[model samples]
Structure formats: C-alpha cells, structure tokens
Target: MLNAAETRCDALIVLADVDHVIHVPLPNFTFQRSIDLQGILKSFLRKALVERTGQIERWDRGTWESFLSPLWKCVVEPVMDALAFSTPGDLSRIFWCPTGPFVFLPIHAAGLYDTKYSAPGHKVFDFVVSSYVPTLSILAPSRNIYVAHNDDFRLLAVRQPPTDGRRLSRLPGVHTELKHIKEVITNSGSACATFLEPSVGTVEEVLGLMNEADWVHFACHGIQDAKNPIDSGLCLANERRLKISDIIGLSRSRGGLAFLSACQTATGDEGLSDEAIHIAAGMLFAGYAGVIGTMWSISDTLAPIVARDMYEHLFRNGTRPDYREAAWALHEAIGRVRESGEVSFNEWVPFIHVGL
Candidate 1:
C-alpha cells in the first residue's frame, strides 16, 4: 500500500495487545506500537475526555495534568524513542494522521508532566512541529493558489452575538481579536471587511462573502452532531447554524484560509474518527487550502491572545501570509502561550492547524 501511494504517507495502525516496532521501505519509514495502547486509549476516552453533548469536555488542570503524564509514558514515549533512533537528524515538521481514540489525544504536547522525568528536548514539540490530516490521499492535490499579500487580497471577519437558544456569553476577547487582526491586515495594505453580530452574521450573508475573501475568520460557537456530522455547524446570530453540509455546497473556487475560532471545530464523531469528517476537514473539502481549528473547547479569555500572537507571527515584516506557513505560525503562537504560563492544555493545545 505504501509503494502504490502517490502522496506522502504516515500510517498509524492501532492493534490490540501488541508491543513492537516495524519499518516499511518508504521515503519516511518507521512505526511502533505499545502493548496496552488500545486499552489505555479506551480508558482515557471514558474519563472526562468526551462529553455527552458530543463535545470534548475540558478537564481541570489537575485532572488533565495527571492524565497527560501516564498518557505520555504509555503511548508517546515509545513512539518518539523509535523515531529518534531510526531517523537521525533535525526533525522539522510532521503531519500526524492518527486513528481511533488517538485522534482525541494531544499527541503534539506529549511529554513528562512532572519535573522528575523532565529533561531538555524531551517533549514531542522539541523534536518537530506537528500538523494533522485525516488521510494522506486527501492531501494529494495541489493546494489552492493563495492570493499574494497586496491591496487586492481580502479578509472577511465574522462575529456573531449571543443567540436566544444558545445564549453564549459575550466574548470580549473576540472583539479584541478582530480589532487586532483588522489592524494588521489594513496596515499591510490588504482589504478587510467585517460582519458584526445582530446585523449581518448569518449563514447566507457569510456564504456570499466567502468567495470574494482571501481569508475568513469566524468567532462563534460550534456544535458537533455525532449522530449526523453534516448537521454540525457554527452557531451564528439569531440562532442560525451554518451547517457543515452548507459549507461543502459553497462554490469557493478561489481557495483560501479559514480560521474557525470556536468550540469543537476539529472534533470528530467517535464512530467516524478515522474518516476525519469533521468541521475542519469539511472546510478543506469546501475549497480552503488551509484551516485553523480547535480540537475541543478553549478558554474565551485566552482565545484573542493566541490569535494576536498568531497574526503577529504571520504578518511579520518579511513573512508571506500563505497557507503553507499557517502550521508553523500556529505552532509558534502556541509556544508563546505556553511560555506565558497563563493557559496550557485547555487553551494552547486545542489550537491546531489542519490541511496545508
């Protein structure tokens, strides 16, 4: 299967009661397994990992920190050890295509939780920057040509107010996020337009602007419908949901980047986890070359901070704001948050870049 593949492949096949390493004759080759990985994954998922509402619930720092330590020892350490021994060099970027419950775990942030086992260059992040794709075959096609940074490049910023049914709390951070992003783009001489709440942040209105905008940033709440993934969507103004099925129908010929700053935008149904048929992947299929999404719920207060840092890195003087650089920029932005010590797993780890 690896030989016949035309695209870059990284297969992570999970099996029961097996602890071994295997190597395939391919460009990037190495695979390792743990004897209790399947059991451990099942146990981890049952604990506050996923919610009854089809969302992945946030665990308190104490709970998650304790959980991460064992998870790192059992699952991540062995895999990293094998990769380090087999591939000797500076590990730069890796696209993790995880399967089953591994999809829900934060493999990028795997490391020793306590200071006792801590050492330099121990965490996964220290080795290589990580991105994710549902499958290798889906990434075969050339990415959508991005509009160069110039006067003609456009950005659409959508901010939805609290709705009656959902009654989401006011996201003050979202206001700050939009302001900073707009200032950055306008200062760079790129065109930017906003759809504010209680007026124009509707499914139909945003869809109309999607084709013209070079980039789209949505600050709102997301819903994951486990029973019907297509019905899952971002909650817009007036209680309207912009379903995944709706996004897939868009005629977005001029592909661009989409920043889904909402809850559960990247969470997939447990039954269909391997398919990667979630909101993030849906955006890719809808024509965007790159997508920024959250695997679970994130702190509203820290959302803008991450966004500000990300745009700062992305719009730095000499850097080009292209989809290819999205993952690197996001990784650095999360690093900034981690350095600050204000927020950790709940905020920093949830922000991930999918697609190119």
Candidate 2:
C-alpha cells in the first residue's frame, strides 16, 4: 500500500498450485487439470488436517522432504526466479499474501530438502526474511505505529498453562520463557512489561491490560473453530476464550505489536478464504502494527524459545524497540528452531509473522 519511496519489502500474493499442494499429502486424490476447486480443496483439508495430521507429529524426514520438494518446485521457485534470487542473500525481506486455501500452507519454509541426494538445503529461509499481510489496505495505517514513539514501549506477556481438568497439555516452557523475557526486558531498559500467568489470564483481565500496553504476547492455547471463525480465539483462564470479536474491539492509535504464540492464529476459514477472519488479522484491525501468529498447532517445548529470541532481536536497540523489526526477529528465531536438531517440518514451520 506504500508509495515507491516507502516500500521496503516484496509482496507476493500467492495463488495455490493445486498440483503440488493438494497432491502432496493426497497421492491418490483424483484430479483433472480443470476441476471443481471448492470441493477438492475441502477434501484436501479433511484428509491432511483431520486424517493424516494424527501422524504429522511423527513424520519422518522422507515424508517431510517429499512434500517440500514439490512445494518448492511449483510454488516458491517461480517467485524466487522472478525476484532474481538465485541463492541466499542478506537483507532481503518478503511479505507473503497467500490467497485461497494457500493461507493454511507455510510458504516461508518451502525448499527442496530431500528427494535424491539433496542434503544441503536450498530453503526459502536462506534467501530472505518472510512475513505475511492479510491485505494491502491493512498496511497504510500501521506505518506510524510501527515506528518508535515518545511513550514507553510497554509490553504485556500472558501465559495460561493447561490446568487440571482441561483437555490441553501443560506448557512447562512458559515459566522459563517468562524468566527469559524478564531478563531481556530488564537489560533493554526500555520496555515496561507485566506478566499475567496461571489463574489471572482471563478474557476480561487480558483485554484490560492490553488497553494499557502497546505490545502484547500470549503463550496460551488457541482454539480455531473452522465452522465458526468468529469463535476462534486464545484459550484463557477459567475456560474463558478471547474471541476474534473481543480483540477487534480494542482498536487504538498507540498499538504496536501482538505476538500470538498460539495455534491456528492465522489459519482462516476455508469456506470464506478471502475474508480477514483470523486472530492475526483481528489484531491488525484492532490497531496493532504487526502480529506473530501460527498457521497450525505448535509444540509447547519450542514456543517459549522462539518467543524469547524474538523479543531479544526486537529490543536489541536498547531504547524503544521498533515494531517493524518483528518480522525479522521472528525470521531469525525460527531459523534457530529449524537448526535445533530433531525438529520436524510441522514443529518449526507454524510460527509466522503478520503485518509490517
């Protein structure tokens, strides 16, 4: 949306290459060059998300490579060529705007990983830092908010670990994550932060605190109601949920960033694919300049590590941290996650940045 002088990154609105994506996990899925797109896409989601996802956690390297190679060949390679990127370069950034069913896919992590003797990776991560934008219009108002401001860069970190009787798993890493955050913020001498852990991270309490802070981080359970996207939200204390409707209500001028370290925060409804209905987009519409969201569920073990590194990178300036740096911070943090031996594709690929 920026004029030529203000443009800093390449924007690629992705139209899903069905041949590569739809056929990756569904080898036996019948296809024609010209097929009913709606029916096929819904079927693909049912199989991959519902059927095969049961085994996604245990996917071997062979399976990971098979899917990635096709994804690179069909989707990412063309974009890279058009941008004149033959190999990895420094300081390159791309803002991906994936259209249709592609929103659920991870475009940032696409590369030819396996298939034959391909060992040294040629992944998209090497060439550029990647971020996402729901739409171009969402960017115009965020320019000023993303920059440094006169007021203190206040931060709110919320952690709602799974308690007894809840179906969710416990997040043991969030404790260490809060410790890391405190250490980072204390050393930065700029960010004024508050923590609401355990029994306090309720819907009303979080919204109340969000009013006082410009930037916010959530290390909690995120529920994605595919049938009703409006109900999709972060799981908070006492079984209270902070739905998308609740978030967009806090629209303000001073907002900077919202780091949603929760599952399916950016995964939109397949039926209404073009609409900006997810938590990340809700945060943007709520007036935050940027947001860090996940396309699918994330491992509790890795989320805190990513969050800690992201904040460290953002606040490296030691004064008021620039919200514009959130994308690069997330990019660098996920790079570490990828290199953190024994990580599968699903584990590292879900963490994504949306907005400036």
Put down candidate 2 lDDT per residue, 28-142, tens digits, no spaces: 2222211233343334334443211113344567666765665466566656666567766454777766655455556787787754534443778777788888886755543
Per-residue accuracy of model 1 over 329-356 as CA lDDT, tens digit each: 8888887778777665656777888877
Model 1 steric clash pairs: none
lDDT of 1 at 70: 49
Q: How many steric clashes between backbone atoms does each model show?
A: 0, 0
Using Cα atoms with residue i matched to residue i, what is each candidate's TM-score against the true structure? 0.79, 0.82
By summed lDDT, the worst window of 10 consecutive residues in model 1 runs over 1-10
Model 2 regions lying over 4 Å from their true place: 1-56, 115-121, 141-147
Error of 1 at 203 (Å): 1.7
How many collisions between residues are there in candidate 1?
Answer: 0
